[model samples]
Target: MKLARLAGPTPVRDKILAIFPGALGDFICFLPTLDKLTRDGEIDLFTRTEYGDLLPASVRMRSLECYEISRLFVSGVEEEEKLKRFFAPYSRVYSWMGSGQPDFVRNLTLLSNGKLKVFPFRPSVSRIHITDYFLSCLGAGSSDEITPHIPIRADALAWSGRLWQQSDLERKSVLVFSPGSGAREKNWPPDFYATVAEWWEKKSAGKNLAVLGPVEEERDKISGRGDRVLALRGLELGRVAAVISRCDLYLGNDSGVTHLAAAIGAKTVALFGPTDSVQWAPRGKRVTVITRNVECSPCLSPVMKSCLHHKCLTALSPDYVIGRLEELLG
Candidate 1:
């Protein structure tokens, strides 16, 4: 359905709804694109309702709810009928997944009674970062067309900064280390992280260093050295984004936090394990990945039978990563 087009930002009703499914970091990357849309129409969101309240007030201008549009089909075919009746009012329907599921997009098109128009941006890994890739879903055009912006809450930044100041860092090149990843096999040894931290200590003398993660996940990465490195556990994800944005550099395993760091414009050094660099590495000019260039690795199929060793990460010594860090910091 061609639907109606808003050619030059002409007159239209105010309310418009955007369908997005992801965390705050994912949504932050879509800010530039969303901001453009909001200039012409009021942007509502369909996401985990918790995000409705969690988003900063600056972003709160957009209404949000746990509208389970993505779950329309899986629930049952009959549920699709309800979606059609429910969404018939909106003039624009956008799927943040962008060509995610043909059926899903078709459903939105159907629900809008052929009155809603669709726009999506899909890009390859080398051509654009995931953030840009996401912006593309909003029909974003060029790199400059989608500017990088993070709506950080002042209160959250102040709270996180106070927590950061409590550390022993007397003004050092702060590095937010995340020795964690989505897959269990992707984590480098905590000892290796400590080794890199210690090595960087001499290089970044007078700089602060701390690791961010859930306390339950990585409490031991900073066990003995209370003064050198601080482990910030139990931070809200939005606050974590705030902390990462303020940091000079981010070093970590392949994880959402790595994405968060790069999205925030921090210089990042990401370590690859099972995930492919071409597909999953942070999309930034300043970002670099340190891996041993192992063979038969990056097998990211979610299931593992038995492997000889996790040499992909173990083969990369702290010295090698630190050397690259020196070059990057230079």
Candidate 2:
């Protein structure tokens, strides 16, 4: 109940609704705060349905369609009265989607009108990790030791075991590589990943590359080829997380998959480019972030609109990543 001290003036109530939409890593970053919130009472989640299995069974997960009601409220399509009535049951609604949809915060606050408390999280433009920002939104102080919370179910672990067994790769020390990200600009070139895979295959006999992500669904983009390199494209999110959980190391871009890998306790070597590594890198005990010190780097913009050449990622040579990979593996 102590962690229920959210930003609004209203008293803590029996139930709370947390509106968290897309971007898997963002949701993972908010998990620690969500875990703390659950101590107060049952928390209803509004996130992408794909992540429902990753969360604890105690919490109730809702579909993405359920969150469209807020879009209507923000767009003025739904009347303020209807919005108020729809959310009246919950004692308070805490939203972290304000950064993407500023109007959602304004409309929700207006509709609440002191009847229901509303905490629309909007952190200042500071150089802090995203997880820190998530905690700060709930009035919690930042801590270096604070890590993302991801609970791997027993079944997920079983699934991972089956994968290794099926491939006759049970004894091999696995290295998961997620070569793709939502933003193409942030990704280190696929050739860089292939170089690492090649080096890993030669250097270590009992090693495997568990290539992950939907990006591989487009086969032409990546040029990695080796019997040891297993492409695991289009697997369910939970299954992907499960497989990464068993791996000894994870090499990836600043992507959601990297966040999941780190959250589940894999040693992570994340290559960050346009996105600020200081503010967005994965947070974990064994996480190492590699980035080029380009002057115009970390544009902090969601899209690479202005810069046609992504020197930040391109400059991060494969040798540099391989060196880091060696340091972690050793």
- Candidate with top TM-score is 2
User: Mind giving the per-residue lDDT tens digits that candidate 2 earns over 52-86?
Assistant: 86898878988757644446445663355666686
Computed on alpha carbons, the lDDT of every model, listed in order, comes to 0.63, 0.75
| Residue lDDT tens for model 1, 168-235 | 44365677787765556777777777877677666757343555555434556554556667666656
Query: Which stretches in model 2 have alpha-carbon errors above 4 Å?
Result: 1-13, 67-86, 98-122, 216-218, 221-226
Q: Top lDDT: which candidate number? A: 2
Compute each candidate's TM-score over C-alphas.
Answer: 0.73, 0.85
Clashing pairs in model 2, backbone N/Cα/C closer than 3 A: none
The local distance difference test score of model 1 is 0.63
The segments of candidate 1 whose C-alpha lies over 4 angstroms from its true place after superposition are 1-10, 23-36, 49-71, 74-86, 96-110, 115-147, 168-170, 206-211, 214-217, 303-307
